[model samples]
Target: MYTIPKTSTTDMEVTSIRLEKELKDRLKKLANNKGYQALIRDILWTYVQQKSGDYQPQLSNSDIRASLPATAQQEERCVLTGKVIRPSEGMLLGLTNNGDMVPLSIDSLED
Candidate 1:
């Protein structure tokens, strides 16, 4: 036997933003092809989560340290903190604080 948890639902105020002509045209097309309101709702949800700094992917420490292809690793810095990123890509391997070398992905940093 399994039990399910109950959750509470809350009401939210909806606000609209004025999009530029080009963007609005594209959005209108997308909404017509798909459900516009649903598309907008998903976009808004992601935007709000990112703005609130509450967005986190469920990943473990070992998951974060997975190997990258010989390519992809690159030096990156924390945008908010500006700390130097160790080399994870390139011919040279990055030395971790624990003295372990890890491959870094330059492309992943852009994301």
Candidate 2:
């Protein structure tokens, strides 16, 4: 599973900014049917994540597992962490308590 870091915007105060009429029109067209505010929020969030080195490309368990060597796959350990995982452990990805995702074996994953 891919987790997107979220910051609560419920109590966020609204602020206004001015943009060129041409730029605003371009943004409106790029936003498709979504509200301009939402589009801007998403764009800013992605930028922040990239700048902070917090953006991680989401990959499926199969993709991660396939990248490992056959011996590692047969051992049922996380390719990144080399941590032994039991077959009953839940989650397809090797997620630590700190919420970092790592490559793990699909056979060891719990339903």
Give the winner by TM-score. Answer: 2
Rate residue 51 of model 2 by lDDT: 48
In order, the Cα lDDT scores of the candidates are: 0.45, 0.53
Runs of candidate 2 exceeding 4 Å displacement: 1-10, 58-111
Candidate 1 lDDT, 55-96, residue by residue in tens:
332222343333334533455432222333455534323444
Give the TM-score of each candidate.
0.34, 0.43
Q: After superposition, how far is residue 91 of candidate 2 from its true place, in Å?
A: 32
C-alpha lDDT of candidate 1 relative to the true structure:
0.45
Per residue, candidate 2 scores C-alpha lDDT tens digits across 25-70 of 8889977896676677777775565445555444334444322223
Cα error, residue 88 of model 1, in Å, equals 12
Off by over 4 Å in 1: 1-14, 56-111
TM-score of 1: 0.34
lDDT of 2 at 91: 28
